[model samples]
Target: MTRDDPRHDVAAVVAALVAEASDGQITAAGALAEPDSLALLGLTSLGQVRLIQAVERRFGIAVEPDDDLVALDTVESLARYLRERGVA
Candidate 1:
């Protein structure tokens, strides 16, 4: 992961968000790496809101209420979405 790679940065950010949301219970060791790991994050509705807010603050991106939240269902997808949105 380099400063020149937005996807890597996005992945790092997503990992951080997942870590924060999980209170470090989840790590970047494939805990949230795959779509199947989404449930392991144990995000509630409020946790989701907090994660969104953290992402917006950390990456300077706005996540509208109508945005397809499913894109964040997995770490890779969230990283891709952030990269597409220029969040790197």
Candidate 2:
């Protein structure tokens, strides 16, 4: 996929948020490119908060506090969310 790919942007955002949450332990784009779990990437509950906020801001959508975060726990899942939620 190109750099502008939705998944790529999702991965980039996920990587940045996870890295910030995990204290710089997992910022590699290559790793995030195929990452299967945000938990594995060190996304804590607090990180998920930042991620949600960032997603809302970057995607220009309102992610409810009661939304299913698990659906956003992976880059692919989030990409699907963007597609299905009519945000992409």
Candidate 3:
């Protein structure tokens, strides 16, 4: 799939994770303001694992340990991350 493919709904993925982790305090758009570090989101080890699983299932792709998602910090970052990983 191309970069603009509908299947690569990075905003939705980020929103889902933010909602799941923060109980709705952050949103897809709001996630853009998060620090450029994955740790700022309080994504614990378990949370990261869950997020990775969700992303994999949603995108129908396998996420390697060194995948771009590990460096993702913002919604845009996540979108580009998936794109770079050839998810769509």
The numbered model that scores best in lDDT is 1
For all predictions, the C-alpha RMSD in Å is 2.9, 3.7, 4.1
lDDT of 3 by residue, 56-76 (tens): 787787778765454555556
What are the lDDT figures for the candidates, one per model? 0.72, 0.65, 0.62
Candidate 2 overall Cα lDDT vs. reference?
0.65
All candidates in order of TM-score, best leading: 1, 2, 3
Q: Is candidate 1 or candidate 3 better by lDDT?
A: 1
Worst 10 residues of 2 by lDDT: 26-35
- Pitting candidate 1 against candidate 2, the one with the higher lDDT is 1
Q: What is the lDDT of residue 59 in candidate 1?
A: 82
Provide the TM-score for each candidate, comma-separated: 0.76, 0.65, 0.62
Off by over 4 Å in 3: 1-9, 21-29
Number of colliding residue pairs in each model: 0, 0, 1
Which is the winner by TM-score between candidate 2 and candidate 3?
2
Minimum summed lDDT over a 10-residue window in model 1 is located at: 28-37
Best by TM-score: 1
Compute the lDDT for candidate 3: 0.62
lDDT of 2 by residue, 1-88 (tens): 7876765565556556556655666564633665577777566777777777777777788876686766766766776676667764
